[model samples]
Target: MVADQFGLRAIPTVYFLQQGQPIDGFQGPQSEKFIREILTHILQTAEELKIAQATELMATGKTAEALPLLKEAHQLEPKNSDISLTYAEALITLNQLDESQKILNTIAIQDQDSRYQGLLAQIELQKKAADTPEIKQLQETFAQQPENAELAVQLALKLHEVNRNEEALEILLTFLKKDLSAGDGSVKKTMMDILSALGSSDPLTNRYRHQIYSILY
Candidate 1:
């Protein structure tokens, strides 16, 4: 069962089991340094266990419960990006955008991975959603000139400013269908921005992205 579960195909396959579950494994000979690093990671200390527990809580939609655990873990490992990112996510979910941004900004630009960028985009989107006057003005202008392509693009930006992302994308899509080469690629850029802010997994983003691909090709 162990061999089958671990998919051991070679003669000297090694499986690192933690609590009867395969956490890490190697199929062949590895250097001492590589083996050491793997072992160090696999063997979690008390603080690591706490962070793991917090991560599970967050995954299960228990951010309130996870926040304290993550805070403790962060205190223990202040520079750990994993903990910081999770904590920032929790804060974002709780509507503590300022605090989340502060934590995110502490992460060095060189260390800003995709997750960091995603969180930052989320924060910016949230901030944009709060700009009521600009959004209202754009909405009024767009309503007055619904057929104007430039107004449509500006209105889409206004919609995105207020978290009406689907509406924003639809506006852009309508304009692009009529003029795929609009705004010297500014239309495509706006669409891409909305898609990026929505993240790659969003169904609407996927749909519109497919449309964009068809238009481009």
Candidate 2:
């Protein structure tokens, strides 16, 4: 069967097959380092073959096998966003939402401001609407990371949703004062948004408004 893959028209003259197998085959999983150091060259050559095979598998609805092959290709070349995206899709199709989300999250965090990460964050936010375990876990983690402006902003938004305006305002202001300087004005805009959300056109809003005006003017 393997010989047929090489387009061998007839029996080989003085055939010397390894264990009656024409193709060199691996029996079991190998270490990541071994695959990276030695098999990378071989994997690069095999990628086109793997993609062809995986496409056939997917066409035949054998997505389970196709997913692993795609994932393997991704491991071989992590920069291949298409492979990573396809693997994430396959995982979703297989009802592996957690794994898919985790992969997307890693991709997003590693490549800040990527469209992939933005999509992942949107998906996470949608899922978080029901107050899932993931959302709760993220909130807990964000609370521990006092220096993370993004997380603070996210948590502040969540707090505002529950009408915890005071807490949200405090968190947002602290984030602005500590991380985002007055010169940047992003934190001031955030403060205005939070104040508007809370229906507070008070002295604080005027102060932030003045700050925003100063930054722009």
Candidate 3:
């Protein structure tokens, strides 16, 4: 039955399922850690779907509607970093900065994940948007020298400061596409920083991450 239902071709096939739907599986024996990771991933995926739905609602200016979804997702996967970040973002959108910061502070300092750092940066930028003069200066420089990679990185960071994340990502992506073979990894690193800020489950992040992987491998 397992072979027929799951297309198992080997003797030691295993399947992981949730609500009767197959999430992941292996065709051979695996380490305990590997199996644990797969199980964790399955749980994470369930929460990710809720976050995606919440994001779509937010994109339509339905922040109030998105909140319940995010809260439910967070509750379902309390240990998931990505879901927690998205939940905090939704709180930010609702002008609940104190609540947002509390969530951000809970994330461990040693994690050092780009997404976590990016969210922290976002909160800071939102708190001091009026006090940042560098943003204006970078904008002017980027306007004058659109092809300068360094300026582009600086400008994109400024744009992200103002929550113009899509524009920021586009700027980095354009530069990376043109300088794919450049010895310096600055462009790629900048792209990853933006992607990590955008969150791992974001479609744009996934798309560009795949593009980078294709180029490197």
Best by TM-score: 1
Question: In lDDT terms, which candidate is top?
Answer: 1
For model 1, the superposed segments whose C-alpha errors exceed 4 Å read 1-17, 21-42, 133-217
Write down the worst ten-residue block by lDDT for model 2.
8-17
> For every model shown, what is its TM-score relative to the native structure?
0.45, 0.33, 0.40
Which TM-score value belongs to model 2?
0.33
What's the lDDT for all of these models? 0.78, 0.59, 0.74
Error of 2 at 44 (Å): 7.1
Tens-place lDDT digits, model 3, residues 10-37: 8688877778998778977789999888
Clashing pairs in 3: none
Measured by TM-score, how close is model 3 to the native structure? Answer: 0.40
Candidate 1 lDDT, tens digit per residue, 24-58? 77887778898899888878876688888988987
RMSD of each candidate? 15.6, 16.7, 17.0
Sorted by lDDT (best first), the order is 1, 3, 2
Cα lDDT tens digits, model 2, 117-148, are: 65566556544554645447757987688777
